[model samples]
Target: MSDVLAADSATIGEPAVNISIFGVFVLITLVITFRASRNNKSAADYYAAGRNISGQQNGLAIAGDYLSAASFLGIAGAIAVYGYDGFLYSIGFLVAWLVALLLVAELMRNTARFTMADVLAFRMRQRPVRMAAAISTLAVSLFYLLAQMAGAGGLVTLLLGVSGEAAQAVVVTVVGALMIFYVLVGGMRGTTYVQIIKASLLIVGAFVMTVWVLGKYGFNLSSLIGGAQDLAVEGRDVAAPGAQYGATGTSKLDFVSLGLALVLGTAGLPHVLMRFYTVPTAKDARRSVVWAIWLIGIFYLFSLIIGYGAGALVGPERILAAPGAVNAAAPLLAFELGGTVLLGIIAGVAFATILAVVAGLTITASASFAHDVYASVIKKGQVTGNGEVRVARITAVVIGAVSIGLGILALQAGINIAFLVALAFAVAASANLPTILYTLFWRNFTTQGALWSIYGGLIACVTLIIFSPVVSGAPVNPVTGVSPSLIQDVDFSWFPLNNPGLVSIPLSFFLGWLGSKLSKERPDELKSAELEVRAFTGIGAEKAVAH
Candidate 1:
């Protein structure tokens, strides 16, 4: 902490690039937001873009929302530092989409009007089910958004030659403001447009970076392969997994837990699920998932070249010289290959990536608060038209504000934003996935069962994380000399694993089943069967209204 503060002080007043092309991105997105606002005339327009998004556009948007700093930086950085272990993260993310495609994308589109709660509460008790689902949505979205904001803070330092808390706070505030603007004015329409643009840029940038890296070695496959395993992993092969997954002092069960969280968690992410409602029909939603699968899959393949190139080119010392070097690898690689000009462009794409994703997350949080909590549950559907939109916009602003504040605090505390994101995935998998699966497929699933799954899962995830090694206490910090977990004074973590998915996920399902059996409370058999028909066949799904 002192070193970072000293570094922050010493690096003060360094000159940054006089003309950041990133300004062009800000200008372009704001114009898109203004244009989209003119079309947002109703609640439907605000929340789900009147369900008019095309499969192709929505696919890009989905990829934009999904690919975070985690994708562009963390994975690449991990690979640069840890050899083959880092590539596992890419697989976890890409394979998760399969679960989203098979279990969620089409069914969620058929069942929900706007949010995840609508699907969970379709045949169950509306108020309790909506409330529980709303809490999970807000939790997952807020956690994910905080990571993006923190990444933004680090990025601003890289871009502007500014370091320290103040610069980070300033960057976070500006990003928060832009995010709120996208959600308020552009709504889903504006958000999706930005997401599509961001995704397109990301794909192109990644492809170019990969080609440039290959060209660096005269396009020799042997050179590429030989040089990529440059990072030495002790007691483990550089070409095999060990540096991270199933490494020394780590359990294989932990590996399985992390994988489970990644695979199941994507299906339960509120922002991703909300994208389904933005499309007009089940077919469009399904098609969008397919499109995202291909685009994101191909995009991740480029990470290898970028990651390995960094190890072979940039090296690790310069990366760690910054506060969070893990995120700096890819950007540093950009600078290495194409100089400051190209670095600025990649930074701009990263800024857009964060903007689009945080907008999606904030809008979903807002909808969960307004649509599910206020409109449906609190007002019993009395709120309509501008009233609902007003609540949603206000909620979006609040979410952005809260996320910025938390991002600053997290950075100051020296928390790993990527690790925080992993915990969030665990929470979503534990707290939300069980309820979604039960409500969608189980005939005897009752309202009590849904509530049990939601709240019980939520509680389990939070508790396990608090008691886990990530927060309570780790044995050492390489720089600090003192332990750096949230509770620095105590080594109270009985749970060896950082991720809580293995325990929490199964517990949630078990609680759902137990609650249903204990109460002898049966769901509406007719409604359950109707949901099966509606979800699978789209017999009476919500349709896009005339715009």
Candidate 2:
């Protein structure tokens, strides 16, 4: 059976065809990035695309950025193996946009210029608040980038039939280099265009696959579900809940923690919040999210079919033994559907998805460092716009190199991309969200409060994660005789939950309130009033961003 699986995967994954398709996609996106770079004449152009993007266009770009490798590759794989419990990721991700749309999107567009630090530092001491926010942004972006980079390594290795740590490391390095090029040359404008193109391709590809899979199951949803269920081991129900997360008390609590992180994380995610500034007005920002919600919603529906289709056709056991493990389900399904041609196309699009996402994350992290920390805090806002942009480009290269090294480590550790993204969400929600909500709504919020929320939450969340089962102490999988934790041959973990959001999120909020009560520095009434006026009315917001 293992031999048959190996032979099938080898035949389906044609290196020549996959490489050709991958080359074509890369060439077209590079040209687009070059074209977009022509108009990057100012910091605004470099950072926020000159705020000229329309509602629909920015919406598509948001979808492109949001529908990452985790969405297409990871979630689909989860559903194929774990059944109904796997679909929870889709639900959590989609519902996250509502929190963004209602709480952050329009207000952030109206209030902030380039990054989350802009709004976060509006009423607080500029230096401290900007420094903390920048740190939090970089942390979240780094975590998110690790997942994309690791996915790239696994993805290209599978496509090219390469089998070694060195080969996978080379693949990760290439992806990191391309991502840096996109940010250094194209900036946000170029990154946005890449996302738009990638988003379109991904949606179209998934739609076609969904249709093909349904046709195979006689166009009946029930038949598809039944087919997947038929392949399940005895006493296991793929169509019912608890297949993955419900067997134990700790696992059930972990599910709740994961849900909290996902549902609240989008509003706090630095890259997602930064997308709001790419549009012209508060209305456009709101429109962008609405459009993103629609597109993202549709794609996830397609994922439902494709995931079950993979289960019915490819089987979980075959997926487990494949080169990419769970992440191989989508491509394997593509291979099963239309042979090498389809597989090539899917592989190329999947790689594009990784490239586009990492480019966005790299740009966001670099921008946060350059704008918030270097320009605002270190330089005391004395830097020129062009100088700041130059710093951002340099930062992009540094961040790219860092992500490459970490990606190789993660690949070696055999971590799941989707689970890594969930950790990123937990960090974002715990560190950023509490301060954002307090700053916007709490009248007595102070600099100390913001500091406590951002730094304290960040410290607590990361510390918990370091001590959690995700990092170590997970029991070995009986079938595979391997631990799922990022670290192996150790059991230092003491935290019970896989995700720390359930604890860290509430703790952060409490700390924010307590810090405010303890602070001797009173809130600035004039700046607070100005912030609220600008955030809700956008009266002087346009002039503030004007070059």
**Number of the predicted model whose TM-score against the real structure is largest:** 2
Per-model TM-score versus the true fold: 0.93, 0.97
User: Model 2, residue 257: what's the lDDT?
Assistant: 96
TM-score of 1: 0.93
TM-score of 2: 0.97
Query: Can you give the lDDT of residue 430 in candidate 1?
Result: 92
Give per-residue lDDT, candidate 1, residue 233: 32
Tens digits of per-residue lDDT for model 2 on 260-317?
9999998999999989999998999999999999999999999999999999998887
Model 1, 409-479: lDDT tens digits are: 65554455556677778889999999999888888889888888889999989888878887777877553
The number of residue pairs in model 1 that clash at the backbone is 0
State how far residue 421 of model 2 sits from its true place (Å).
Answer: 0.8
